[model samples]
Target: MPAQIYALDISGRRTRPADPLSGHRQESWRVNLLNNNDVLLTQLVGVVGGEFTFNVNAAIRGSGSIEYSGTPLDWNQHRVQPIYRTEAGGAAVEWPLGVFLVATPSSEYKDGDRTVSLEMYDKTKILEDDLIPASYQVAKGSNVITAVRAVLALSGQTRTAFEESTQTLATAMVWPAGTSRLRIINDLLESVNYFSIWVDGDGVFRTSPYLSPADRGMSWEFEDNEKSIYSPEFTHDFDTFDVPNRVIVTGQSDGDTAAPVAVAEDNGTGPFSIATRGRVISRYEEGQEASSQATLQAIAERLLQTGQQVGSTFSIQHAPIPIDLNSVVAFRRGVEAIDVATTLQTISYSMDTGALCSTTLREFIQ
Candidate 1:
């Protein structure tokens, strides 16, 4: 036969503000399931204007009954008013529940909209044999805990792989600036058929097009009528120029002079520095895949001398710059990852001004 369990009752109350002149006031009361000792498991606070919500989680155990009630203090006393109730089964079990309450003030209550309050109750059953007082249980003879750890490890690996794949795709397409131009170039590279042509900054025209049957499958053409301009600009400006007062040097020989080294004079802050303002510019005709390829190759070679590749993926990011006394230094940093294989293309740039800008070029491959 299944074991029988008793219901637990819960209850609480809060006083309402009294009228200033009449001196009449009332208290609000609420009730819920209580355990064998009549200790209330749920309590309700004073409600205002008819709406309330709270974050709560609850769990109940055993075949126990639960009940809730509410009463107003100005009127006759009520023993128990049921606001919420639930029944438990004979077997040991956990029941999770949340409660919300809404109430309209009586006509005699003065000067307010409807009243509302939210209450939370958690119920759990304790078993006689399994109950341990003031202590947590340690698992002795089961692999459940270890199995959970293994599952977490597998999930972590999957999450890591997903993040890596996302980052790889993100770095594959370079978008230094001009996202709008990148979109246009990506579309042209993907959709255009015929010959691919590009106009360079110096006005050079180049093309790679599918030739008619008379000329065979494909041909490349270059126009020498106009010179293309390459004007990639890199500029840096310094905001401060105070020179350091002290210079520290190591490895002074015993016979060397012991006088301190002279402080170096400060150079006037300018817009360009050999170190800060170095940039490369290349011009290619509308459809010159070879020019694009060569340009990317050159840039990659230059970047290789400065930064290491971030993995199998092609992305170059700068290392953290060390601070120098009284001045900030800017360096040229770039990466070239996408290989141009087709003629139909678009060029993009990152710079805010100038005709030839930085952009992410998307080339669609069949």
Candidate 2:
């Protein structure tokens, strides 16, 4: 017996049609249609090309052909109409017809590794012709000493030390004296912890604390066409002097008088007090031989102490003055025996200079 086949119409309904023209068609051909899900087995049948029609409930829908009995079978179905010539005709029948069957080639699949490389580039440079100004203006009629004190207060330095340094610098320089005062003022400003001293007509004297060159709000650049200028040559002397007795006084006096009187008396005191007094006195003298050495040393020591308590409170080291009390004593005795009298003078310090001194804190007690 020929193998059974099944197919669906464009509407996807399944129906098995009868051969009305073939004598082989029985009055009631109970042809068994392939099971709905088992239709794929028809491919193994000998059917090569023919059309087959079948009917299924409205729920079954699809399109495709099957082969059976060496013939291609195409199947399709139409909705039953109410008006029918015969009641039997009204009954749906799945019809089978011969058709051409062709298998579609399958798609090819390929898999391998894919690699991609990415590159990035960037460039940066400054192109502006004019940059912001590097200059600062000193307020008119500003007292350098007051400014220094203010800065010192801001930096948390001792008011007494700041005031003392301010007074010393003020007395050392003539107020508003050209650019000398300004230069000194600029040199001393770093913060509230560091102060500067320069030798004026009177020996070593403090300036109103000003910002250090590095800390100054101002920056300098050579003119577009100007050449670099080097610093002037300076001589370094290492002569050592012995001091027998040294005295330091705080009161103001002429540093140029033929016989300058000691501002305070110094009885033989403890070594530390005597040495400190001697240092203070030696710092105040006639001629431009003033020494910031002592002040710097004291500031450095203070900085070290501050660092011990906190850490790296300031950027620059405080002044480092190495004082040998023995040397100081010998030097003082020589001066006393020779009756060498140096006058002390007082002058006003510039506002800018004073500001610098106020900011730097003393890092050491010495």
Candidate 3:
């Protein structure tokens, strides 16, 4: 593996020097890419960001710990962007991990040298720290994109600056009274069929369809024994704890309390004794336009089917490539011959040896 180039930019500025940071006096860096499905503090995290850890020799900035002594590095900054690239066949290809907010920087003495480890997070961290304005609100009958833009604009962000799907909300989102921006985004996501939100390496906010890939492009195959470099950790289970067997949707418009309602139920769960299990009900309140009985029933049925096929997650380490979440991919096990087209869920990347990526995937249903 030839040496990979790396550069550290301040305040999300793009740095393109003749000689990159890899040619400078740094050891290496590791990046952990996370998406909405990834959990943090027991909560679902979103708008894809990453934890970047890098080690640098003290000779570059003098050997001193900021926690103990004065240091030359600026700890307070808007963003720290890390750009990396590999040289192959005399040509170089670059991959810029998203700009991150420097969280912590620690220094230690190892052998005869002092090394520093800088930990950073993506810009989405701002969302956690900042609160949505109390007076902010989305108008009735506004589309999902419009609502998202309104939410983002609270923090001086624009939806036009991010990658997003053209899909709109089935009904207008209700932002009754005061609501956090995070809550508003999650609610909008729930109303859409397969959409998700994430931030990209370019610092662009993205609201795109995931877990439902319209295009199944490319595939990665692994066979047990000698055919593959590694095997994936796969598991499947059924727990009735929060599993719903029935769903009810009620359509109610303002000043019209006599709207119709719809319900969907599942009567078969094999011979596992349906009598022993109680029905779990999910209730959805209609906003904006009153939903028809057929629409409500369809929504219930879709949820039921999705719950039934929750599917397995596949985690594997393979060559690195920028794969977006919810994109369709093919996975095959040797001798099985059955090809599984699935959704790319979460991604983790490491560059100690070479450009390698570990990704988690959820099976996509037809």
Candidate 4:
């Protein structure tokens, strides 16, 4: 694989090179940087040491981050992205490994080479730095999509990618002064079905709904066969300690009225069901932004409906591929019962040519 790294000015402004061979241009969605509406910088000249690894976790805030090592270059700016040509000179297909914030980097001096260890985080960290000022109030009956866009704009974000949300608020949403802007956004999204909001490969804020493994289809499959993608290692783990059959969700109460409450119980008649378990293993959560009992009940049901199959994870090592987060992948061991299915929760890999990648997948409830 042929790979190239691009940079942006410290102020996040630059022009995309008109020449394709200039090392500054890659086939990707043209994104205007957060600081300015310009393209990327000239390519860095050096040998990159570890994998060009990126991370996406099942989280509401700070869901993405990246780390890698390379020979020292003039890198004082705060932004970067990597593009790799899949088959060096074989095809034109390239992968843009997402833009990132480059603030904390360490260096090492070997026998002859000077390598810098660069660990950069996603743009969510930037949003976490800005606190919402006083008088930031969202009115009742406001659509959640509009509210999320408005809050991002207040933080000086102009580029965003959002899933549709036509659900309206039942009561006005208000937050006290001096709260993290990203926190407010997280709260607002839960009013709809979205639970994980993070930046994508092109450096744009994006949101998507959380679904059980049962609701998604497998994106890739692993088998210990010669025709497969060379999965060299495999590991499986099952975690049932925290699995809950009942979930109780409640909304905040006002000065005079009690909060709306809703209960979601395990209705499945499986081995882990309330019937089989012989007791109600319940989980409780609060602060749902709703006013009607129906809305609260829907949120509670969504929370309980996920991970009901005793959430587990299986890991594998294979050739690096650009699989999106929250993707469902399955593995087939020879034994019938050893076969497993799950969702891609965390992934990281290096930039070294032909370097194998190790990733972990969380089992989706069947």
Listed per model in order, the count of residue pairs whose N, CA or C atoms clash below 3 Å is: 33, 105, 2, 4
15-96: candidate 4 lDDT, tens digit per residue = 3322122112222222112223214655544434434444454333223223334444444443666554432221234456
lDDT of 3 at 36: 30
Predicted structure with the largest lDDT when compared to the true one: 4
For residue 173, give model 1's deviation from the true position in Å: 50
* Candidate lDDT values, in order: 0.21, 0.24, 0.46, 0.63
Alpha-carbon RMSD of each model: 31.5, 46.1, 11.0, 7.4
Model 4 RMSD to the real structure?
A: 7.4
The runs of at least 3 residues in candidate 3 whose Cα sits more than 4 Å from the true structure, single-residue gaps closed, are 1-72, 83-92, 109-116, 133-135, 159-179, 192-194, 209-211, 214-247, 250-255, 258-306, 335-338
Residue lDDT tens for model 3, 1-366:
012233325443434433321221222342333333221212111212223321111111101111212233454633444444543332334555564555466666758555455555555555545555455544444566666777777766663443354545434445544555756665565454324445555556665433324354544434344434344444333344555556666654435456556666666653211343654445354541322345445556655545543444566665454344445666766554545656665655544445446666555445
For candidate 1, what is the lDDT? 0.21
Task: Score candidate 3 by lDDT.
Answer: 0.46
Q: Is candidate 3 or candidate 4 better by lDDT?
A: 4
Better of 2 and 3 by lDDT: 3
- Model 4: how far residue 115 lies from native, Å: 3.2
TM-score per candidate, chains pooled: 0.13, 0.17, 0.60, 0.79
For residues 1-366, write the lDDT of model 2, one tens digit per residue. 011223334463655643222112112111123322213232233322222111111111111232223222332211110000111222332322111122331222237422211110000000011122333233433445555444333323221323333322312332232323223333334222343422111111233343322222211121112221111221122212322133232222335543222322223453323454464322232222122334433333333222222211111111111111001100012212321111111111111211110011111111
The sequence of per-residue lDDT tens digits that candidate 1 reaches over residues 122-225 is 11111112222232221222222232223223222111111011001101122233223312222222121222222211112122322322233112111111
